[model samples]
Target: MIEWFTIVQVSVAVAAGLLCVVLGLAGRKPSDLTMGAAALVEVLLIAQLVIAIASPAFGNEPTGSLLEFYIYLVSAVLLPVAGGFWALIERSRWSTVVLGAVCLAVAVMVYRMNVIWFVQGA
Candidate 1:
């Protein structure tokens, strides 16, 4: 839970979430731009996962239930892929809405993870 990384991750997640919601409200289906943005956010989540798990090697460990934190992190990582697949399958505005909601969920999960890391410090 590096400070700078967490800040960047939260900022990106929120931005991506807002973008997804906007795209959904605009009635756009899955498109290159939208999917790419989601993918970007997904990559960031995975990167955060890597850093979090490896932090202990660098003498940092989150002072929380590491397993539970991992569950949230993994879910955050999975959401974009799930939402993308669902959007592809449904191919409607509602599908985009689902993606938007997924992104928002990811944002919330990211925040929770931060709390878990900060409040329950290693």
Candidate 2:
């Protein structure tokens, strides 16, 4: 729930998501670039997981419903994985678009999680 880190995650997610979508719309199939973008998003989410785990010890616990925050965090972590798997299995432009869509969805979810942690709880 660190504000700066959350911003970074959202920015990266949006950038990567847009890149994939643009490429897919250009009739590109799922390639390393698209997959790599998805992977990058996953890596950020994993980092977020680690941060969440350790933040409480640092006196940075979420101010909202802990259960709801964790649910969003965990689900956001899974979206890229599922999308990547789908892309790998399909190997089509639409699959690339799907991967991009997943990234965008993750970005939204992460933002919501932040809101739950900092705004909704208040």
TM-score of each: 0.91, 0.97
Which candidate should be chosen as best, given TM-score against the real structure?
2
Instruction: Provide C-alpha RMSD values for all models, in order.
Output: 1.5, 0.9
lDDT of 2: 0.93
Question: Which TM-score value belongs to model 1?
Answer: 0.91
Candidate 2 segments exceeding 4 Å error:
none
Cα deviation of 83 in candidate 1 (Å)?
0.5
lDDT of 2 by residue, 6-94 (tens): 99999999999999999999999999999999999999999999999998999987888889899999999999999999999999999
Per residue, candidate 1 scores C-alpha lDDT tens digits across 6-31 of: 77877877777788778888988877
Clashes of each: 2, 0
Candidate 1, residue 1: Cα displacement in angstroms equals 1.8
Clashing pairs for model 2 are none
Q: What is the C-alpha lDDT of each candidate?
A: 0.82, 0.93
